[model samples]
Structures are given as C-alpha cells and as structure tokens.
Target: MPAAMTIDLSAIPADQRDAVAAVLRERDALKEINRRLEHLVAELNHAVHGKRSEKLSEDERQLSFEDLETAIAEVEESQDTQLSSKGKTRRPVRRNRGNLPKDLPRIEHVIEPASLECPHCQKMGGCGVMHKIGEDRTERLDIVPAQLRVIVTVRPKYACRACTDGVTQMPAPAHLIEGGLPTEGAIAHVLVSKYADHLPLHRQSQILARSGIDIHRGTLADWVGTAAFHLGPVVDRLAEHLKVSTKLFMDETTAPVLDPGRGKTKTGYLWALARDDRAWGGDDPPGVVFFYAPDRRGENAEKFLRGFDGVLQLDGYQGYNCLTRPSRKGGDPIRVAHCWAHARRKLKEVFDRDGSEIAAEGLRRIAEFYRVEANIRGTAPGQRLSARQARTVPLVAAFGEWLQEQRLRVSAKSRLGEKLAYIHRHWDGLQTFLHDGRVEIDSNSVENLIRPIALNRKNALFAGHDEGGRTWGRIASLIETAKTNVVEPFAYLKATLEAIAAGHPKSRIDELLPWNFTPSS
Candidate 1:
C-alpha cells in the first residue's frame, strides 16, 4: 500500500555516494542529540522555576520504616513457601468504596408503591390482602449548618428571712472567656478551623454571618489569643517532652510576619522538632513541637536546642554545625545525622539537568542502601544494629570508595562533582544510620509534619505580628501533635479549653496531652 525507496549505485559517483550517506547519518544523529539537549533544558527550567513538590515525588520512594518491614516480611514468607507448578493466575484488584463514620447519625426514608394490588390477580388490593416482599435501601450523607445560640445561666439569689446577715447566690459556671459571647465549643471550633483547616478569621466571620451571627473578625482573634494563652502551659510541657528525647527530627520553614511600622511583612522561621519511635517499634508515643524565631540564624537553633544532648537529624544546614561542635556549652555535642534524601535530591537535580551516568549511578547506590534498610526496618535496636553491620556496612564502604574515585575523575566545579563532594563531606553523618538503628536515613518525617504549616502559610499569606507567629507555632504544635497521636483535634481542644477554664491543675498538665487524653476525661 506504500511506496518504497530505491537506490541505484550505478546512477551516482562512488565517492559522492559514500559522502551523501555519511551526511545523512550525521544529520540523524544531530537531530537525536538536539532533541535530548532540548529535553534537558526543559527539565532544568522546571526545576529552577516550577513548584517545590517535584522533589517530594522523588523522595516518596523512601517508604516509612514500618511499612517497609511489613513488605519485607511478606516477601520472605512467600519465598519460603512452595510454589505451584501451574501457571500463575492473577486476581482482579477491587476498588475501595469509602466508608462513612460509624458515629454519624443516619436518617431513613421508606417508599411504597401507590397500589398494593398484584397485577397478575387483577383484583382490588390483590384479593383484599397485600404482603411486603422486599425493599431496596440506599444511603446518602447529609449535613446541618452550624447553629448559633445563647446559653443563659440563671443564678437566682436567695436571702435568709430570719437573719439577714448576708445574701448568698449560686456561683455562675466558669467560661473560657469570662462573660464573652462565644462558648468553649465555639472557641474550639474556630481554633480547629483556623489552624487545622487553614480557614482565616475573616473567612470564618463571613461564614458565621451566613448563619445570622454578626461576629467580628477582631472578636475571633481575641478568642484565639485567649485560647493560646490558656494552652501555653500544655505547649511548654510538649516542648520539654520533645527536648528530652535522645533523638529528634528537626526542620524549619519560613513564616512571614507583618511589620506595622514598615508596612511590610518580615521573615520569620518556624522551627519544628518531631519524635516518632513507632517506626522502630519503640514504646514512646510520637509528638512534635514548633518554635517561632525571628530569623533562621544558627543561634535560634542553638537556643531552641539548648540543654539537649543526643542525635539531631536534619539536612545539611551550616546553622546546625554549632550544635555538633565540641566547644558548645551546657551539654555534650549533638550528633548530626544528615539526610540521604538531600544528597539524592542534589543528584536528582543533576540527572534531570544533564542525564549524567554518574548521577544515575549515585541514585542507584543510594537506593540499594534503602533496600537493605527496608529489610531491617522495625526490628529491635540490637538486631537492626547487627543487620546494618553485616549487610549495610560493606555497601557503605564500597559506596564511599566509589564516591572518592568519582571525585578524583570529575571536575570539582561541575554540578555532578559538587554533589559528590557534598556526599563526601557529610559521609559520616549520612552513614549515621549504620552506627545506630534508631536514626532514620532522612529527616523526611519532620518535613512531612511541617507540610500543614506550609499549607496554612499558603492560605493565610502571612502572620499579623511576631506574637501572632508565636501563637501560630504554639497552637499548631498542639493540633499537629494531637493529629500524630490519632486524637480528634477538635474534641481534644474543646475538652482541654473547658478543663483549663474549670481550673485544671497545671502540675498534672501531662494528663491533657494528646497521647494520654480521653474524651470523657
């Protein structure tokens, strides 16, 4: 159906024919090379100007330790079992139909036919009798808009008739905001909506107006500040708990605060420290606390982490080097555990930009380390240490040797060379997991914890002031910690606010922590 090309050697000179063929081959090769070059340029542009989440997709390959452990066990069990000689059969994958909460109330509606007479009988009411056969049922979710109402407290006064020495009246119930318009539940709702759901105060006020509640945004801010003031003690306890941990995953993100005098927003840092031992099967409950600093200087990190001596997991930021220095005061030097994900990110950028084989090999080598980690994850600390020594130690040594060899071969100023140098400089820290089983390969857990703050930042744009940023940090700490512990944040906040209003003792404040919290309590 198609025409075919035919070439005749006799029609053309021999020397010219060879030259023509060479030119055609060269053109084809140039076209392919130009295509690749264009692709590389596009990838570089996307990396430099596109969204930051492109890197997150690459990092997601490093699964959580618990999940990796389960996968490893399943693979091992399958390998140990006998296989059938018959060809393998594949089963269909079932799609998930999400379930509604069991606690949610359900409303039922029943429908019956207009006439109960059977069509076959053709008699009125089917011989004057009808029986039910079956019913088809369907369910749909519904919601009730938030309702606003007043809670009137009546404290009737009584006087003694015989002796009017003194008049006594029943005491009024305690409220989070004394004589304030909103109730404890209302304040809790606002806090959860603002911080957890990232709804700004003005937007919440607008929503409330639709319900016929004429509350000002300023009043909502006052309620938030009041709630933060009462929750201060609990946040303090959370900070203390986080500081005492032998290991912590730390990261920081920028938070802009409004400057009244300058009429512009100033940069601030929201420092996040998280502890999650469940990945290693430890008994300690997972929690995270945040601190807001005016800047991202090393001193802020030093001040925040003062009186703490243990492994501090983070990315390669020079600010943290002070904590790891021997001359640091108040405690032993904090061991720095650098994130391999960061190094992999550097290599990933290089690979995306130029498609270098060295960068690809570096990623492959790092992936191997993660593969060994997957096999040993969630085991006892001692067992994990032994497995790393036997399995991971050699791979690290070989990888280090390969890195050194590549460093000597490549130019120091090249991008791939720079990434290799970074790995060499942080080699000890990157291999910290080989020394201790408790340390993770990266600080992604804390990074994941900080994602909500990033979301809030995108919504709110900036904080009102330095104090407002601090309040954001404090409130986010409690809400995020509650989420980490699987506690319903709204229920926890409502109960905690009520307890504080009712004069709950600060000495027993730990009882109100997300881990120890119960709705009834």
Candidate 2:
C-alpha cells in the first residue's frame, strides 16, 4: 500500500493550513470514479442496436415512377367515388342550364359618330354593318419544353484604316460555362435534387438523358464536388458562429459509406449537434449543426466541440464525459448535463422487455414532471422556473425517494436493476437543471435538429465515403442552422458562395453566419 504524505500544521498558521492534507485523497479520487460509474450505467441502458443491412440498399426494387403512378391510380379510384358523393351533396343548383350558350357568339355591334351617316341607309344618327366575331373553345395540357437555350454573343466591330488610328474591339459576354456543359439553373437543380431531394447523381443523369439532355453521371459528380468545395468555407464560418451559442444538444445516427475494397459498404455515424428551443418553447426557433465521423470515439466529440462553450446537453454517450473534465491547458471545463429523456428512455426500454412494477411506478411519477414542464413550456424563463419549483420539485423529490426505495427490491443482475441503477447513477446531474434555469431536461432539441438528415438518409441511402460524409456534415450544418434562424438557406448559400468567389477573408466570414445574417427584404 502507498503511504500518504502528511502536512505539518504546527509550522503553518492554524487558519491557513489543514492539519491533515492527504487524509481523504482517496475519497477525492472516488468522486471521478463514481462519475464514470454513473456514465456507464446510463450508456448501457440506452445503447442502440443494429444497423440497417446493406442488402436492403437495392435501388431497383425501391419505389419508382411507375410504382408511384400505380399507387396514385389506386388512390384516385378510391377518391373518385367520394368526389361524386361530395359534388352531389354540395353542388349548387344551375338555374341557367337551358339558357347557357353552346358556343359564346360573335355579337358584333356597330356605331358611328352623330355627324356621319351611312350612305346605304341614308340615316343621320348612325351607320354600321353587323358582322360575327369568331370564337373558339379548347383545352390542352400545360407543358413547358425542357430545352436548353444557348446565349449568343455576336460582337460586331470595326477598325479604322487611316494612318496612326486606334482599333476598336468588343469583348464576349461571360457565361457560366464558356467551355463547360452546365448552366446555373442546371447546377442549382442538380444540387437540390441530390442533397435536398435525395436523388443520386447517377439516377439524376439517367433521368435527364431520358428527357433528351446528353449529361453524363461523371459530369454531375464533378458539379456536386465543385459546389461542395465552393461552399466549404461558408460552412466553416457558420460552424464557427454555432460555437458561440450557450445551449447545445447532440446526437448521432448511422451513415453508410461505400468501401470498394470490401466489395460492399461500411457503417459510419453521422454525429449532430444543435441549439434550439423547440422542445421547451415553441416561440423560440432553433439553430442546428451536424458533423459526420467514422466512429463514436470521444475524440470526435472533442473535435466537434473544440471552440464551443456553455451548456452541452446530450444523450447517455460516455464520450461526452471527457468534456466535463478539467482542461490541462486552461479555462473552465465545458459544463455537461445529461438528458432526462435519455435516462427515462433506458428505463422504458427495459420496461418494454420485462414488465416491472417498480419501473412502472417510477415512470408514472416522471411523466408527471414532464406534464408540468409541458404546461409551462411557452412561459418566460422566470415563470417557468417558478412553476417548476412550485409544481415539479416535489415530484422530483418524491421520485428520487421512490427510486431509492425501489433500488433495494430489484435484483442486481436483473434488467430492472440495470434500469434503476441508470436512474440512480446520474441522479445528481439529472437534477442539476432544477437549480440552473438554462439546462434542458432532454436532448430532444438536437434530436429534432437531426431528423431532416435522417429523412434524407432514408431516401439517399448513405454517403459514398468519409470525405463525402464530412461534406454532409458541413452542408447540413449551414442549411439546418439557417433553418432555425428563419433565414432562407439557398439565399444564404448563394450569398456565401458569391463572397467566397470574391475573395472575402475567412476570419471575417463570421458576419455571414445565419443568426447574424440580415436577409434582403
């Protein structure tokens, strides 16, 4: 056993020094150990299982235009009967049915000045000839031609042929593609189709070629990559601005990456973070960000949160525990609050597997706390705190007591025991928010932020590689963050691209951040 180093209090002033400095150093060490234990318990209960199988990525069997048309036909057949019934029930009586015109007639009326008289009629008032005005009725399907129109720049020029005369010249107008094959609309269409609409480049090329555009898949790929490159710095600037926010939520989901070496794809995680008020307040919109990494390693989180500060609310991923620790270099450690929903979710999962009476009661009590939260969700922060204290603090206290009592009844090895342990382990951090008003009860804010990416993932399948995944992270960060702040994403993207093209300095690009961006009216 290692002996403890003692302090001599007799040499030091009684008010300035402790009599036993190293007496409980082991106790201090146990504090961190306990924190780790708590983190582990929470993580074990909330662990997600299984990735979507790669065999499920068949493009041919998935819903296509014909399948969609068939479905639409079925829906229309069902709706046609309802439509007939609706018309019979609500249609007004047609009073002029018999008098209605078969064809709108040419009722030509003639008039003349009072001074003029028709020679044939010999009238002093007016002279005119009645004639039928032709009319036609028809209907055609409205369709715009999908043809490319070339811009012609015919620069007509002349030069003087006299001695010591200067020559005149005309320059050609600039085109998006003087030598290339894509137009601005084509670029926007491809980007929106791929990233926003989730149609793959190969699929888009096939669709375009079918419509008479001789575009290749490789050309579309170049356009996408070039766009991402041009847009990269704008994303970085947006990310820098995202760091300055006070509250944050974080989560991750699987993103498949193609591996030609393995003759298949590999599973990767798309890690996302956000700051928003949706779960807590409907009035306050959210700013979101996403980052993709190959693994769920803690260093990835560290990299993601490098410049970020303030409260970071996350699920029960032990990787985030590293942020709570003191930095060896300097400054305050990033404060972390574990999500209550995450803690509750674990217990719910176990409850689903094996019905436990104790877990049931605990959940019922926790649900009451959420009920109180929901009631005051839209109120001001001070009022929310007051209501929480008045109504919710008692529930939390009673729930804590119930948890302590129930912890004894469950078996240590049983699933119920694991769930109880999870709730007990993070009890302090879980309740920490009751004291501070800024911390949220759950990571749902970030979860909501990442949902669009999840939807896109379902449709597009996965990123091609790690670099492609990073691009996903960068683009999602800007677009989603812009969404929270109510800034038009394309407008932001266009302006950002223009700035980058104009050689705007990177350090000063923070002014273009979504929250700070002032949009044109």
Candidate 3:
C-alpha cells in the first residue's frame, strides 16, 4: 500500500471531510502494516541467502528463520485475512517432524475396538477368519509434571547383648547443604535453573510452590550463597587456568547491584575473560571466567588480569590504556589487540544512518578479511599465520592506502571521517591479528559467553548486594565454562558438589572440573 496523500479537505464540504479523514487514517494503518511485513520479508530473505560481512552459523540461521517466519504469520490482522484475494484452499503441507528418541521411556495405551471380529464375518456365520496379521503403531510426545520425592536414610541402631554397650550406627553421609532439605542433585537443579535458565530466586520459589514444596526465596538465596562459598576456590582456580594462556579475549557488562548504605541500586561490572584455542587448533581447551567488581575502573581490570602477560583481544575501551604502558609493576606489560568487529561496526553504523558509499566500501574490505578467516578457521596457528601473511598482508596494505586517501579527501568532523579516524588511530591493534596468529580478530569469544549474564541480569533486574553480584559471577562462570566444554551443567555441578561434600582433596581439585565430567563421576 502507498502512503496517505495530502488533500485539500478544507475546500470540500465539512460532513464528507470527516469521512475522508477516517479513510486517510485507515490508509496510514495499512501502510504501516505493509511496511512491517516488508521488513520481516527482507530479513527472512537475508537469512535464506543474503549478502553479509559475516555468516551466521547453520543452526543459528535455521532457528532464526523458523521463528522469524512464525512471527510474520502471527502479526496478521483481521483485514489481512480478508485480503487473501483468490483464497485458494491449498492443502496444508505436512512437515517432517523427526521421530522421537528411542531412549525416551514411553507408556503404551492399547486402544481396542469393542468387537475385533468384522461385522460381515459375523453376519456370514463367521466364514472369514478375523485374525491379527499385523499391528499399527503410532508415537506422539507426552509429558508428566515434575514431582518432588524425598530420599529416606535409615541408620538402624545396633546393640550388644552383654556389658551394656552403647548402641552404634554408621555416621550419616555429608550433604552439600548441611542438614538442609535439598540433596546435592536438588541444589544443582536450583543453581542451574537460576543461572543457566535465568529464573530468579522468586520465580524459582514460585515454581517449587507449584510442586507443593514451600521454599522461601530468601532460603534459596542462602542456598546460592553456600554454593558460592564452596565454588569460590574453584572459580579462583579457573581464572588462574585462563591466565596461563598467552592470548585471551576480554569484555565487560554492567551489573546493577543494590547499595544498602543508600538503599538503592548501583552499577557494578562482570568482566569476561575467555580462551578458544580451537580457532587455531591449539592444545588448550576453551573456557571463560567472569569477575564481578564494584566499578569498571582501570585498576579492576588490571587486578583481574594480574598474571596474564600476553596479548588481550578486546574492544576500544580506554580504561585499558594502562596496559599499553611500557613499564608495569607485577609482570611484563599486557599487550592489547583491539577488535576489528568494533572498527567495522563504526563504519556499519554510518552506513545504517545514511547510505554512504565510503562506509559500504569499508565494510566490503572488512568482509574480505572474514572470508579468509572462514576458510582457515580450524587450522594450526603457524599455518594460520602463513595464510594471513601470504593473503591478508597485501589486502591490509591496500586497505590502509585506500583509508588514508579517503581520510585526506573528507573532513574529520564527518561521520565517515570519524570512523576512518578510529581505524587509523587503532591501526596497530587492528593489524595485531595479522602479526600474531594466536590472537583472534575480535573479542567475540568472550562476548558470546557474556550474553547469558545479560539475560540473567534482565530477568533478576539487579543483584541484592555487592556480594550478590560476586555470587552471580561465580556460579555463572562454572556453568558457562561447562557449556564451552560441551558438558551438561547440571551433571557437572551435581557431581562437583557431591565430590566436594565427600572431601575431595584440594590437591586433585582439577579432577572436578568440567572437562573431566563423566556420567558415573
């Protein structure tokens, strides 16, 4: 539908002018509806086969398009139903929903007819035999409400017949929550539900209430605090483990914390440090450790990265300018490698605001870098270095020359000029990947890991206190790191809690980590 056109309603009769205004309003609504539909259609086409600076993963694309199309359908209004034109009654396509897993326990319901014998056979004095030759089977999914069950521990008393011996029984087994109602498995479920599932304590309490269990959200917080206390050492170990790597990705997000002194919420931070060696096929396993700090001061980052001495790939945050210093107290100066995604995004913003050919060309050049990265992604670091040097070196040189030429022609005050300036200012860090194969082109590794924290933050709104923020970081760190290792969080956490309660030695603490996860462990 076209936009509503302006008309000389004042020249017409007043009575008809009112009707004309109403029609104009309706036309505007239609125009808006059409616009919404067109936008969704464009995104759908893009997901299907679109021009992009980077490609979304296959699973990501599939899930995205499916949801996008469903939303498109749900946006239809009553007038849209009437606009079907031909309204041809086409058969609804039967999509193939894959078969249910064989491992899933199924309950059988044998539906039988009142009479097995055919009516014709009975009428003909049973001349034809109605015997079973085969059985038809159909499977549909069903669900049972989750039920809470109690585990009873029996410690029978034993007595000696002579000498008035005291009654004796084996000592009760230790639990993660000492003498509390929840078992290790139950605590693990609660932790996973809150952190990974992003269900706040109040919501979880409500969920537990549905199962006839009365648990206060404050008690849930206590449980989480206890879990945090025991998990602190583990998180410390994990952070130290991450620091061992020569190169790592880093980023931070705001964590709103309640300030009891002022009786209101204050901004905090959860910094993510990540390592993904599979990109260059290195030996170190992937992991992420989140640190919660009261503020995003330079010292906070500096403290968190004390032992980490090598390249840190991150965004254009000036707080990390301290790392650029030639001389720092503790160890060798931490080298900073800035993100190309950040640089590209600067120009992409310009392109979005106004269709600038310069911005488009800049994005095109960045896209070429990603294209090369896609091919040699899983190769070894030395091999990646060889590929980048041979292929990306000349491209980078050409891009730099082109950037300088454009910058000279445009004013520094312009949007395109400002973005080009950013690239030029961070020219050394932007080319860091070309020099060191171990470092990634961007800090996306850590950014991807931090997304759940954002989701959790949104749901919970804010942490109750400074300690609450720290507790959030500790539990989330282990859960998300488990995911990076392809380990199921519930299982890993359950086993770890059990192991801790059973007095697993600190000397072998690494045994309880996610990578060592096994079903029977």
In order, the Cα lDDT scores of the candidates are 0.84, 0.67, 0.85
Q: Which is better, 2 or 3, measured by lDDT?
A: 3
Question: Would you list the rank order by lDDT, best first?
Answer: 3, 1, 2
Task: List TM-score per model, in order.
Answer: 0.80, 0.68, 0.84
| Candidate 1 Cα RMSD after full superposition onto the native fold (Å) | 13.7
Residues 160-259 of candidate 2 have per-residue lDDT tens digits of 7776476666865433344566654566566666765677788888888787777888898777677677667777655655677777777888878887
Where is model 1 more than 4 Å wrong at Cα? 1-98, 115-126, 158-168
Give the local distance difference test score of model 3. Answer: 0.85
Best by TM-score: 3
Q: lDDT at 88 for candidate 3?
A: 36
Evaluate residue 198 in candidate 1 and report its C-alpha lDDT on the 0 to 100 scale.
97
